[model samples]
Target: MSYQALYRVWRPQRFMDLVGQEMVTKTLKNAIITHQTSHAYLFTGPRGTGKTSAAKIFAKAINCRFSKEGEPCNECETCKAITEGRLNDVIEIDAASNNGVEEIRDIRDKVKYAPTEADYKVYIIDEVHMLSTGAFNALLKTLEEPPANVVFILATTEPHKIPATIISRTQRFDFKRITAESILQRMIYILDQKNVDYDDKALKVIAKAAEGGMRDALSLLDQVISFGDNNVTLDNALLVTGSVTQESLFNYLKFVLSKDTTNALKEIQQIVEQGKDANRLIEDLINYCRDLLLYQQAPEMVSDGELGLLDDKFKELSQQINVTQLYQIIDELNKQQENMRFSSHQSIYLEVLTVKLTQLSTNSEADRVSNVDLSQIELLKQKIENLQRKVDNLSSNTVQTEKNNEPRKQVRKNTTKGQKNVKINLSQVYSVLNNATRQSLNELKQVWPDLMNMLSVTQRAIMHVSEPVAASENGVVVGFEYAFLCQKALEDQELIDTLENGLDRLIGKVPSLVLIPVENWPEIRSNYLKQRKNGAVVIADDTSEQSQDNDDQSASTQPTIIQKAEELFGTDIVEIKND
Candidate 1:
């Protein structure tokens, strides 16, 4: 026989041998003992959490002729046949490869036949979420109502992708990720059975590196064992896992906390020279800082099993740094970690992070040195008084200039009565509205959806409730559903620029954007039309007196507006009969 991997050699033969899934195994065992097993079962969880293993164990246990206490007796021919993968009665299908309707239809056709030699015909579908939509639909009928001797076991890492109809027909079981402690104990047990001399700390490191997967832990353990010449030493495990040793992590943090940037960079250089990953080093440092925080708050609760607890040196350093400073360092490192993913120059980011961490302490020391001296207090006060006197003189001059300019502002206000009350360049928007040709607007409206699709999600959401009510060669007036939305749209300069670019792409011209509330659209249109009819160019003004004069002019022009309103709203709604 060829050399088998540790994971395959140590594959759990019985449910009791499975680690970290007590609840699922107990439930399946009870169902088998009570002879109340469902026809179909769905196992969903992260990869390597014993979903397929449990399915195989359950299949063997249910069909074993000499089953003992709901456990499969591997001595039985029926159990042995399934274990060796030579049984016609038991089938394991990889849905990733056979995820077509034709493959599923074949299963549907074969599901009608009875088991040849076993009590049941078991079908274990791995990565069942990979099945196509048509394949899933084809399997629904057979899954919902299979033969009495048939059982379907569907396993997938992502359960949310499976159709609800298929999930509803099966008894779903969600497997959780195995804990590090559980993985550690399982590795120790396997090493002990193999008579391999290993360090306990090394096993813990392997367990941490596994990230809650038993298969991954065993595979890493196998690699470390070979690297250590069958002796699983701490150094070999650290090298195999590419994990920073506890001493190196403590020394790196010590240099950072002490504000020694030179030594900190040196430590990073040493770590890089040893072929350690910068990203993994950052992650380990983050975990190390987290342990310090936990140890500071509750020393008794911090244990060696939880990603290696802080040592004496780390505990001493923890007291030197306060919680706020530690949190800031962690936050800065996390941001750097995110940036490192897209950057090829990862070492540069790491060095920058080192400098940032060292600066926190230096900045605090600088803040301490910046205290005011009592000897210079009187001099500072005198200088402040002189500054106040200069500010008062400047304020008086400003008031006098405003008073001298008041009459000129009033004269300008009278000149532009039908204009806006705010000082904005609305002449371009006004011209667009006045020369509002249907062809320009219709061209923009035709490609509005394409233009909108070019915007980001947030921009699309903000502009979804608005539409182009009026357009011209150089500007377009957009009307929004609510007043606040129009206000918000006008305030976002970036959104305006994006809209301009998008419009330029779609309509071949970058038009100025004008936003208005839909409720104010009619009044604004009426005012513009009234001003245009009076042969007046309405320039925008910010003076209050100008707004009041415009209101008075609107009241006087009601008779002309009524004639225009009759054309739009009909004579009945206009009601110009002596009113």
Candidate 2:
């Protein structure tokens, strides 16, 4: 006999042989035992979940002459004939290839006839969702009221596509995805029956890679068996599944957790050089992180058998990073996974992810510093209120002084040569400074990438040179890399509108734009600070002298927060507001 695949050769012949669908199998067997089997039955689930196999087994059980307790005796002539696909009474249809009104009409016309040899005639249609709309309509009436002793079985992976009218006329059985444990047990049984040498770890790897599909697991096992010359080993399983070894994943994660980007990149380079897929490496890392997180939360829940070769180092690493850091890493890796689908330069993203992971600990620390306690927040609020009161007093004095002075009528004049020109929106700049917060600014920065993604290619390119530097509730200050781009961006009303729409979609609010060139940012910011100092009363929140010292130190020791904000928002739209 010619070679047959293990999945085909070991196809389930009885409900008892089927794994991971006890509810479905038990229900069908009970229906047969009670002699209350429905005329039309619909089976739905993921591929290789045994929908078709269950349908076949049910067909044999209903027709077998020597059936006992709703189970088919395979030795019977009727069972053997159906199993061999030569039974005249039992018809198997592949709806994918023959999904047309004419084919269903033919079935509809033939279902009225009685069985030729068996007690009942059975029709098994696989992938019934592939049937055309008209074909489904044709099958509906016959399915609703079929001839006596006739059974119809319709199976599909996608139950949503089937028409409601057709679905209402049949008994629906939802087959679930087979569990890994069940799949492993079944594979071990088969291996033992065949007297094949196999490693338990190799079987586990196969089961995990199958992703709840028995046929897929068996097919992978068959390939591994052939590749290993009848002895299934862990190495063979990894080669077949394109899965990284546990040691490699652990080492890569260890490098990331320890903030060793250089070693991490070297490890990735080695993996890539060995012909391993960059995407797969990322997937493995993400899974490892997930396992580590799970292990941390419920150590007893996670078994080494299920995860396939876990080491004590995973638990140690879990202890090294908190849950928040692990969640952030997983989220970033997931985003990279999505990016990999669209990007041809997957390795670049992988390298970028490695660097990002190494920085998570530092970023978390910085976040802790920025997220002050409630008492500190209340103190900051009281100081802001005090400053507001001082500003009010200063404003009243300025208004009285202006009223006391005479109003001068000025003549309209044009600027001449050698005049230093300054163009700044003082009112808008003041509003942003008054309302700015580390939290709101960080919020905008977080969604900036998403906003950019929503923009058209042209708009993104036009606005790429700019970023949000300072943000208020009602407005944001955008800094441009080049003065010309800033000028152009201001002139392009359509681009601004697109940005507003994109902001609304991504961040749920849009703010007014305050565009300034990077070259002119320092001058503009200095002028605003000078105006605030000259026009407002200095309160004793942080002594005026200390505030000045802090300002000078901030400028000298590091860039001002505004400068850091400029870098973060990037010469683009810095912030957005609802109004």
For all candidates in order, the CA lDDT equals 0.81, 0.78
TM-score of each: 0.62, 0.64
Residue 91, candidate 1: C-alpha displacement in angstroms = 1.1
Model 1 TM-score, 2 decimals: 0.62
32-137 in candidate 2: lDDT tens per residue?
Answer: 8998888889999999999988988999998887888889999988889989999998899999999999999998888888888999999999999999989988
lDDT of 1 by residue, 1-579 (tens): 998999999999999988999999999999999999999999998887899999999999999988888999999899989889999989999999999999999999999999999999999999999999999999999998899999999999989999999999999998999999899989989999999999988998889888888999999999998888899998898888899988898888888878899999999999999889888998988887887788888876666446453567877877887886778778888999999999999999999999988887534443455544543676667765665565456557745865786666434344332322221224445667876889988988888889889986567666777888899888888877644456567668899999888887887889878776665566567777888889997653311111212322322223456546744663335444472
Q: For model 2, what is the alpha-carbon lDDT of residue 523? A: 54
Q: Which segments of candidate 1 are over 4 A away from where they belong?
A: 307-309, 361-579
Q: How accurate is candidate 2 locally (lDDT)?
A: 0.78
Of the candidates shown, which would achieve the greatest lDDT relative to the real structure?
Answer: 1
Clashing pairs in 1: none
Candidate 2 residue spans exceeding 4 A from truth: 304-308, 364-376, 380-579
